[model samples]
Target chain A: MNTTVHEYRTGWKRALIETKISLTTPGDLMGFVMPTAIAIVVLLFMQGAEFEGAPVSLGAMNMPSLIGMNIVFGGITAMVGALAMDRTTGTLLRAKSMPGGMTGYLVGHLVSTAMFIAVTVIALLAVGLPLFDGLEFGTPDRWLMFLAVLVTGIVAALPIGAVLGALLDNPRNMGLVVFPIMGLVAVSGIFYPITALPGWLQAVGQVFPVYWMGLGMRHALLPDAAAAVEVGGSWRTATMFAVLALWAVASMALAPRLLRRMSRRESGSAVAARRADMQRDW
Target chain B: MGHPRPHDGPAIAVADLRMRYGDKDVLTGLDLEIEPGGVTALLGPNGAGKTTTIEILEGFRGRSGGRVSVLGVDPAHGDERWRARLGVVLQEWRDNGKWKVRDIVAHFAEYYKPYTDPWNADDLLDLVGLTAQGGQRVRTLSGGQRRRLDVALGIIGRPALLFLDEPTTGFDPHARREFHELIHRLTDLDGTTILLTTHDLDEAEKLAERILILAGGRIIADGSPDQLARAASTTAEVKWIQDGRLQIHATEDATDFVRKLLATDDGAVTDLEVHRASLEDAYLELVAQFEAGEAAAAVDTFQEATR
Candidate 1:
């Protein structure tokens, strides 16, 4: 009988429905699995290489790092793309017309995106475990750390994505966010150790969620001795979680304001204008 | 529900509604009122701000200045409970492409559960004529079928007031006819107050019980379809053959003219036809009259004539 209880329960159902949709729909399924497949291909090429005095092959080191990259892409870039697509398709305006529909919609996306990232990261780990010899994910404590890192990574990434998604009305402008993330991954040492990058680039990398999550994942799965090749020559575990938690807090505080502003401006004419611009631009 | 039924005043009341876009003024001192039931078609030329007016009422857009009340709540301040009482279907929508038709309907119906009992999803789909296409994905439906789905989603919450912006755009004759019947069924089921905007006068005449023709950002004619037709143009055109030649004449009194023609030249008149101006003609005349710098006089005259 309570309104908030009913709305949130419906939101939970929506998330389940959307998760099924993403799993079955070809375009959506491809968006989720394509990055993992590419990571496998890239790791295949790195199988023979090893970092100096590191405990595992370069491929094993890069495996969990790539999982971090998935969290960023699935949580940030993909979320932004979904928001932009929904705007052009009038889905957002449709939600605006319904009572408590916006609340349901936001909760649904958050839950569904988290599930997709979970599925993607698990798939990558399953595929990587047999291929890499030194992955330390078998221990119970390692699993706990994996769950912790993934949760904090999503918390850090999704809100920033929502904030950016609210700001970019045009889907064409999505490239503005995607390319920068791609550039950040390069400097963030997803495919290489942060110690190999220039000190300034490593410094730039350490400030963002992507590099911190990669470090957290490495701390979770890679043999602890592999920390010799990391920036601090030991897993700076506290700093990793603290940095991600800080990003999550900052983004969480700012996202709702931006999202409300964005939803307030959503009307039929606004959707029509965006569609018209898309057709013209395309 | 915090919002009890409020029917004493007009369902929608707008006074001095004004909208401006940068340098252009779309609506200037526009005022309107609609009672609780029946369909009212808002007719206006493009850029006359029919969409703007409807959006303002739907609480999707904020007005520059006006006193607007929809369902006894100012739309600018209309809350979630206020939104729960209204339904809106815009001209075009391509949403939820991956969701099945019936699934989407049943899914959206859940959002209204906090405020009101929603329509049964199966019955709603049948009413909107999407029963056969229930299992089909939304993106696969034809244009008419898609619009019917749009209507189904709009009213799933059993809204007391519904706003349809050009409900039937780009519909073939057959589809348009079916859509009109569905609209009739909706209004008859509950006295759901509906305000629709459309460019098709025939559709307006057929679906709406009352028609308000807006020109120059104001309602120039407001009455039933027949009244506006009669108010704007009373002169009927008469065509007849006399002495084996065709003759055409316009007269304010067609019955008298025809009687005189038959009395004076009964043998010579072989073919005769009388044509009264239709709603389309009256609509064009009113817009033209308003554009030629004599709108106030023309509208006043039509108001007097209609009265």
Candidate 2:
């Protein structure tokens, strides 16, 4: 008998590429891209509108709002949704059993989520450039600020996404997560200005990372005049980066422990029973 | 049977393995030994703890209590090297369903070191009779074809020990035959040790060198197919013709009886025949015995309590 020796060799790039290509599924394209597209177009029309007291051209606001939406709905939400679906389907357990599997697979997912967020950002930019006529996209330092916000937002949101995925164990529970976060998005100046809200509501909005991410992007995209009226000045941009970074660090630290705990509860029979039950019911 | 000396032998040795789910125990002090080479069929009905034992051996599930050694290492603490030595085809996989056939196969290739270059995933496609659909999405493939893909992925790593969980459950007759041939080729050519579980008795009879039947989380019987078929306690059903009319008999020694009957009757025996017992009959008989034993034990306990 040769009794061959075996070793686990994982190609990170290949894994990442495979993960990216899988994002073309219909549910993902429809659920993620459609809403962002609608938000952008609506903001474009709203930019040209004259409100009751003032003429508010929200066209410029579209970029920041879309960016904010991308962080919550696109980056974080999709990451959590994907992992949750994998757990529900037994894919995560199956992968974890393979050699060098979990690390390779998760690295792939992170890359894929980052790539998707980048693509969504580019698509939103392309749509924004053509839709609003008075919009003059500049070589403003705003791009740096937007990139900073996006990176921090995605990194921070990933741990929370992973924790939710680990804790929820199913996609429907993830839906519960989506509604509340969407509620946060609605109140957090993504659709309209949070500044227009009452004091208590504005305080509630500030507590969420989504609001800070949007505020940071707005400082980068909107002209100094509009940004000053909303968030004081460039000083708030640093604060946004620091706070979001802290959340990211905290969530990342907590994710693995939560994942391990959840894994402890998983058994082949129980999973099999759950799947059988799901098939019978659904 | 004499116990074989433990001389750094056997690819897998499991003893006193026990597992529980809530109040019900799935595996109750079960034991198993798998030697290297050929296939060992893990046979059991639903909820029989066949999956539990296999999962624990594969390091995918934790056993509540037991000592298990696979390839000289305890599976509970086995590392990536241990996992790489084995290939597992699970009951279901849905992650790569969205990927194209070629991409999915090629991508999995990177997960193993010293893996042979994908030798005609198309040729394999042809072997599994999936050539016409090689480029199609896996999700679009029929259940049998997808199962063939699962087999393909399992063997892609060229594992030393391959774990197959009902590999042909959804397969039609033709696909099942093809899959059997594929399995035979793997063992013959590469000398891969395969541990498989199946509800299909025919599959066990055709493929396995040794078979283990599990019931109520215990190994009720384990031997070669013929040895199990002729297990001392199990009866052999026999049938033969005595005159122009047909005659049927059930006995432990059909061959001996047939010879004696032929000698006494001279040329009276028209259709001298003896039907060979099958694994299915032996299996059903064993399960029945186990169930009856449990019932009797329960009644005995009741009687003792009343007295």
Best by DockQ: 1
Q: lDDT, candidate 1, residue B70?
A: 91
Supply the DockQ value of model 1.
0.74
Q: Please tell me which predicted candidate would have the highest lDDT against the true structure.
A: 1
Candidate 1 residue B186 Cα shift, in angstroms, is: 1.3
Candidate 1 stretches with Cα past 4 Å from truth are: B1-6, B238-249, B254-273, B285-307
> Per-residue lDDT of A238-275 in model 2, one digit per residue for the tens?
67888888888888898889877766565455566667
lDDT of 1 by residue, A118-214 (tens): 8878888898889887889878999999999999999888998999899999899999999999999999989989889888998999898999889
Model 2 agreement with the true structure over B1-307: per-residue lDDT tens digits: 1111222577889999999979888888899999878999998765577788888888877888989998778987876656666778877666556778877676666555443333346565665566777778888987777877877777666666788888887678987887788788777745578999986667888999998877767776688877766553234555656656788787667768777877888687775566665556545554454456563343233222222
lDDT of 2 at A132: 59
Instruction: Provide DockQ values for all models, in the order shown.
Output: 0.74, 0.41
Which residue pairs overlap in candidate 2's backbone? A47-A57, A47-A58, A47-A59, A156-A248
Tell me the lDDT of model 1 at A268: 95
Error of 2 at B301 (Å): 19
Assess the local accuracy of residue B208 in candidate 1 as a C-alpha lDDT between 0 and 100: 90
Task: Give all candidates' CA lDDT scores.
Answer: 0.87, 0.69
